[model samples]
Target: MTITALRTPRRLVRVRKAVTRRFARALTGDAGMSTVEYAVGTIAAAAFGAVLYTVVSGDSIPDALGGIIERALNTRV
Candidate 1:
């Protein structure tokens, strides 16, 4: 159509791009990344502690692993 009509669409596109860039920059910066990493590490540590408790309690561990340890204990070499 006319140049004035085209200007509106171009300005809207520029605004959308600017907002998206700011949102992306906020997520990729160090603060957000570090928080995500800390959350993942905390979850991993909790999972490891739960599994350690299960193994130590020995209520229902895997048969093959139990057999291996028993064999190792009984043998010299």
Candidate 2:
């Protein structure tokens, strides 16, 4: 209808295209995780696994589980 209204949509389209291009460039610019990041992540995962293993292998958990099982089995009903 009006010249301003027609120009407004064109301006919006240009702005949207520019923003999309910048976003795409940002996403594809990096080649993903670097070697140092991978190494650090692996080390962190190994440490977490070691801690988890230590916790699960400790006596308290197994003893608790065994107690629960024994009680359930010995229930009169």
Candidate 3:
């Protein structure tokens, strides 16, 4: 390609400026959540964690885990 082809012209410069302005506005725009959204997200995450913890530490899980450990310890290794 020629050097002129690689060089940006006025139209390309205008286009680049437009795109940069658009991107700037988009970045600074309210595309994210407010404080209430953050609070809600935190609460949801905490609730999900609690549920996971409850399911993992349930009676059947503990019994199964204790049986595995007991067998492992009693094995004549």
lDDT winner: 2
Per-residue lDDT tens digits for candidate 2, residues 28-57, read: 897878999999999999999999999899
lDDT of 2 at 3: 100
Scored by lDDT, model 2 comes in at 0.96
- Give the Å shift of residue 51 in candidate 2: 0.5
Error of 1 at 36 (Å): 22
The superposed Cα distance between candidate 3 and the true structure at residue 68, in angstroms, equals 2.0
Q: What is the TM-score of each candidate against the true structure?
A: 0.38, 0.66, 0.52
In TM-score terms, candidate 2 sits at: 0.66
Best by TM-score: 2
How would you order the candidates by lDDT, starting with the best?
A: 2, 3, 1
Q: 7-42 in candidate 3: lDDT tens per residue?
A: 768669999999999999999999789999999999
The CA lDDT of each predicted structure is 0.88, 0.96, 0.93
Provide backbone clash counts, one per model. 0, 0, 0
If both were scored by lDDT, which would come out higher, candidate 1 or candidate 2?
A: 2
Cα error, residue 32 of model 2, in Å, equals 3.2
